[model samples]
Target: MINSFEVKETNEMIEKENLDVRTITMGISLLDCIDSDLDKLNENIYNKITRLAKNLVKVGNDIERSYGIPIVNKRISVTPIALVGGSACKTVEDFASIAKTLDQAAKDVGVNLIGGYSAIVSKGMTPAEELLIKSIPLALHTTERVCSSVNVGSTKVGINMDAVKLLGNIILEVANNSKDNDSAECMKLVVFCNAPDDNPFMAGAFHGVTEADAIINVGVSGPGVVKKALESVRGESFEVLCETIKKTAFKVTRVGQLVAKEASKALDIPFGIVDLSLAPTPAVGDSVADILCEIGLEYAGAPGTTAALALLNDQVKKGGIMASSYVGGLSGAFIPVSEDQGMINAVEAGAITIEKLEAMTCVCSVGLDMIAIPGDTKASTISGIIADEMAIGMINQKTTAARLIPAIGKKVGDKVEFGGLFGYAPVMPVNNYSCENFINRGGRIPAPVHSFKN
Candidate 1:
């Protein structure tokens, strides 16, 4: 297994093609830290996080230095605050205070971000869960590094239209609260349908109750590597193109497996999954759209975009499964507009629209991600959009999420620059027609007939 040729190829992928591990996330369960006393609960949460994750960043750095693999970020995800604070958090303010404690613990440990300020109200909400949901805008507004998410629908339980309706207004409040930062606080929040238990990525990651106390999960990305491989097979048959993607993805995932094994051994934490997603950044040529273009599209929203995305997603999972036994999370191609420069270019060129992006999510890893819309768009319309995406995920049995940023005071043709990996996005136009009548209906959408499978 130790071959010079393979080592050289891996080195070239890193040095030339922007290949790197996106994140090495430590998932810590906070169930043991719960308390009935508000002050005691906050103290327990902060102390547990700091004590367990004190060596996270240092371990990541050591691994990167020793293996010459670029680990972009070290993150932590914990038990959803809704469950952990249920006994102690009697009010919305109590839940918001927990966010501050989580933020402080992250700062002390030197991680880039800490997730799990979230609720799982897929079918219904407990009073405490509802309070945590209400506190999201304030929690995110006050905290620097805490990320939040809510799972409002799933195949087993159906869509919670009441929670969906509430989230629309909550997201608007989050946008208004951080208007000075281009409404960047909205970027730290995600609304999901069919959310996974062990996602290592931000805004949607929570340590499920079923998981171990603490574990190591790594997210590895290489959109540039895929695009470059596709270029080598230009004008080839579909069979040939598919083969190249599968092989290249296998190699990329092997890199992730190496890093995950090394980090698990060093940190003495049980290794979780290696999420082999082709997650893009704002950097040049490192885009999921670029891979689509190399697959014979003029732009990302071209005629065959969905079919191309489906093919790429399938082959990625196929190859990734062969590389690692524990392949999980959103392990496919991520098509976020702001994070992928090619997608932003597509938007600026008038080649992509919100409707087209929604259609694309049926096949991509996430739904309508990192998109910026005008502030004037109504909350009902946002809820309507969430309902549509939830229906897609619920029926298809796939993980789908929405991370929309309604730029305050920004309209179509205006751009908001978030910089860094959170990139910049042009305010794409949203349909102005009112969906108020439909969104006002406060009830659940029953699960599909196919959900009755034993």
Candidate 2:
């Protein structure tokens, strides 16, 4: 239990910084559901999820109400289906059916997003993994809440160029197929490098084989809270700001640890990691970009913002590490352009650009998230963006991803609405450079020299 001083400090930080719990993710391992028969596989997946997650929402709600803080999303990430249903499926459509079943199960259990509709082909691709990857467009198009990811690279085995090549086409297909939803369905897809299995955030979360049969992880976000804490210290020295952010993050993460511990106890599932990402919502006051702006930038994406974010990201991790022994996932500030109102406003006002966002990815969580590019953009360009982001993750020994949607027929300055938490974005331009040579290298970019440390 946290002491009164800590709690008081956290509350004060919340009042001044706009901090709150971002998400409470429950991880349900579906590996046990794997069987020779597809029907049995489906039944097992549904039953295991239902049993493990039956009380997830209730526990989250109770925690939120009791703590007087918001638990914005109640999400579930299951084992990657390619691993679970690989031997059972004969066709891509079979995999699609499995995806549908998972989606329906999430709805039945009242969860918002059901992740792990994914394949890990970073080293090589299995037949089932190949089929599932091919079916992502159909699965994501047809299902309401199913999120998918394909891990194309990692530090140990490097990236599989074949898989990387396929993803370029896959994303385009998903974008074209879901055009009616403003390509919002594509928003549910993420391409990752060194992806964590126990992640709880949507579009990227997945239950890994190393997890327990069932576990509940909490992802707490409070960018507003962090920003509020920095407001009065605007004219302070950089070192002072770093210290302030660290102290503030300590309190914010403490709240998350307390809520996750209590919630896990109530659910009777072992406590999983506390993903300390500054996940933003479409809500006006809850924007991560707003937090950046409050830290002295006129808006997110202004010059000097990346340096500020780098310090903030590092300090948050330092504080969070002190606060919890189980801190994991993408534990940093998220700059999803669409979901964050401040980011959206920045893009619209020309204060931020795709190139600057790319640079910011060096020090932040996730990359090119919820960004809209011109529909006419070449597939090679999309692949370049992905490769660039993956390179950052691979080289930095950190988790980074790209969740870009090329809105068909939409160009720069045009607004694409995704509705709800998906939010809206003004289409941003990508460089006109041809990435054919870089992408065609057709082999893994070796892990960074730093990753070779014994």
By TM-score, the best candidate is 1
Residue 297 of model 1: what lDDT? 96
Model 1 Cα shift for residue 245 (angstroms)? 0.5
- Candidate 1 has its poorest 10 consecutive residues by lDDT at 357-366
Q: Candidate 2: where is the Cα deviation over 4 Å?
A: 1-18, 449-451
Best by lDDT: 1
Q: Which pairs clash in model 1?
A: none
Q: Provide the global lDDT of candidate 2 against the true structure.
A: 0.84
**Shift in Å, residue 61, candidate 1:** 0.4
For the record, the alpha-carbon RMSD of candidate 2 to the native fold, in angstroms, is 1.9
Q: Please, what are the lDDT tens digits per residue for candidate 2 over residues 1-454?
A: 5687866776675665566776788888887789989999999988888887888888888977787777778889988999998989989889998998998889988988899999998888989999999999999988998999999887766767777878888889999997776777789999998899778788899989888988878888877777677776888888888888888778778888898899889998888888887878777777778767767788888888998789888998888888888998888989998888889888888999888998899899877798899888888788888988887778777787899999988888898998877789999989988987877777666666665667
Per-residue C-alpha lDDT of model 1 across residues 1-454, encoded as one tens digit per residue = 7599989998899999999999999999999998999899999998989988999999899988887889999999999999999999888899999999999999999999999999999999999999999999999999999999999999988999999999999999999998988999999999999998889999788898888999989999999999999998999999999999999999999998998898888889999999998999999979999999999999989999999999999999999999999998889999899999999999999999989988888887878899999987789988988898898899889999999999999999999999999899999998888989988989899999888995
TM-scores of the candidates are: 0.99, 0.95
Model 1 Cα displacement at 408 (Å)?
0.6
In the order shown, the candidates' Cα RMSDs to the true structure are: 0.8, 1.9
